[model samples]
Target: MAEMLYQRDVYGKALVELGKKNKDIVVFDADLSGSTRTSFFAKEFPERFFNFGVAEQNMMAAATGLASCGKTVFVSTFAIFAAGRAWDQVRNSVAYSGYNVKIVATHAGISVGPDGASHQALEDIALMQAIPKMNIIVPCDGPQTREAVIACIDIKGAFYIRLGRPKVPTVENKGKFEFGKAQVITKGDDVTIIACGIMVNEALAAAENLAKNGIKVRVINVHTIRPLDNDTILKAACETRGIVICEEHTVIGGLASSVQEVVAENNPVKVLCLGIKNRFGQSGSPSELLKEYNLTSFDIEEAVKKVIS
Candidate 1:
């Protein structure tokens, strides 16, 4: 088994690494520094971190203010608060004029487990995507989370990076992470399985299983959803018989919608989306939640077969 690492575990250390190099890099947390792992950066640069207790809107607004001062600011909190509570502020303040504020929200999707529906941020990506120019990146595991954090140092304008609460198994990914490029893990012509975040690992497992059963499957890891990597995704759609999009988010307005829009506009292929199907999350263990939501590797395998059929 691959060594499991919490996706947010390396986040603090990565922020600290950036803090060491950049004096103008500041961070804002809405009383979730510990959970978001921004505490490491706070401990490293005490003067550069600020905590606004339970005021995500204020925290986001202040983060934009710092960005206006030509500082690269990062705002951290639960995804529900960052994308739900501070949405108006995030849209009008941060994304309006393309301010350099990175909103890295932790505990996204049903993987949040006992945090339940109230705290789960299944709609975060959809909300962030509503604002034009808000970059979205959902790193699948710890290693990619580190890469995403470090890459945000130079990424201009507003960004929405989604991270989960529990430890995630590192999936097979080759080469350095390019901001807008999708990593094609395995190449096949029968079908393409494109996924982001924790679902990437499940997609890989499904692909491997399908390969064993003599069904060729292509796996594409789309860490950056905003930029969408149309080139790579379109290429896969053109080459493959069908497409299966997997996300730990809602099927309506997240990865599934984005891919469908792109493919429909360009090539119009048979696509099946395996994700949370228009239902709020409920409390359970991470594994149990994944199984209940039908987001496991077995689900992806079934979705792939359906798309091909």
Candidate 2:
């Protein structure tokens, strides 16, 4: 099969489509508009675009104000700044007030590459998932990122959509996925690989490679980090003897963390968590960083065999 195109253009294209449909839709950026692809919306609707410089807190407050007034506001920035810089505004103004503002944060995880630990957002998912009334989403690829942006407008509450700096493989088609719904990319009985964000592609590739060695693997897309699809995870875990979770985020409080939460309460099974193992990122390309952090497809395949062995 031919490989699908991978680029951040999916997000840019989705913003353009949404901007054309809804007049209440607005975008706010914290000096990283070009990087986050919110600049695409700004291009068409310059009147509705607001650049908040580097003041992420003010941008958060402004987005909350827009949401309160019935406007679907999208706040864009790097994941590090979105969570680390404006976390107070997000928790107090957005989550505490229960605003409908969408936090479309990008450049998440070790995939950030080149920027190092200061810019990489390894712990963002854990921090945001702990907040009350916050909807957490980690889209697998660009197409899913576009879907995530469109879905954030309909969901009424504080939302965090984690995006990456790298262009990931498009394993899913538009409108074929949804929020709080897990996508089972592949099915098997030996082990289930529940993943989200960029790791979805990695898990799928790992599954294909594992099949050559006679290991059966199931791949699932756990897109919604908060309000996680517990039923799908539990079902997959119960059917498969073991589970392997893959993500571009830290293993502490991301897809793997959510999977563990469900498996611990419902089913007892052997689980292998694949991600950054409690370490900060360094400057390099996305692929280099993933390999350095042991988040490559080979690593995932090896992890599955280890758990089964």
Candidate 3:
């Protein structure tokens, strides 16, 4: 069998379908409607769509206002703006008010390709996860992203959906979905690699590579960041003697930080984090950026080998 390459179009189609059935599910964008692909919803439901130019702060406030009117408003923008620029509005309005607002921030991490550091959102998960009443989700691929959009529609309070620009492979094909839960893709007793978003694919690939060397590695997708899946994480840590945390985002406050907190209190294991260090990425293609920032499958393989050794 061959590996699959996912597309973002599937998520757009799912959003269109959800908009047809749920009138309360409104869409908002910050000028980059085409880039984020929320324009599909805008075309289908013009009456329920609002574009706030490049004003991400205004868009966040407006989404909160719309949510106040009993609407499930989904505000879409580049992750950099949705979480970084509009952090104040998101924290005060949507999070503090516990509004039914969904924030879909695309182009997360170094996967934004040639756009480089300015467009890449390396701290979105950490930034949004810090807010109270915020549900943070980082779907692995297009199909999962679609499921995430549907799940966010009725999820209570405020939520953040982190998306990447690069097409990511769908790790799960079971056609099931849930919020605030981690998906354990594979089982192993040697080591566990907990990752999310685009890094999920890399982690799985690394696990396969490690298997050839007689180092069985388990892979878990911690898609939901805010409500850290403590149960699954601790279970994996206890089962696997050592652990490796991976993500496209910065290591400071991303998946590594989340897993570290859980392991500190519950299960202690030799842990390694694979992500961009305290450095900015230069302009390059997505693949090039991954290599430059050490966010590739090879990097994960090397990290696993090092941890085991």
lDDT of each: 0.91, 0.85, 0.85
Instruction: Give the top-scoring candidate (TM-score).
Output: 1
Could you give candidate 1's per-residue lDDT for residues 80-168 as a string of tens digits? Answer: 99999999999999999788999999999998999789988889999999898999999989999999988877878999999999998
Which scores better on lDDT, 1 or 2?
1
* Poorly placed runs, candidate 3 (over 4 Å): 1-7, 172-175
lDDT of 1 at 161: 96
- In angstroms, the error of model 1 at 252 is 1.6
Model 2: residues with Cα > 4 Å off, grouped in runs: 1-7, 172-175
Which candidate leads the pack in lDDT?
Answer: 1
The TM-scores of all predictions, comma-separated, are 0.98, 0.96, 0.96
Which portions of model 1 miss their true places by more than 4 Å?
none
Worst 10 residues of 3 by lDDT: 1-10
Sort order, lDDT high to low: 1, 2, 3
Where does candidate 1 have its weakest 10-residue lDDT segment? Answer: 168-177
- What is the Cα-based lDDT of residue 168 in candidate 3? 69
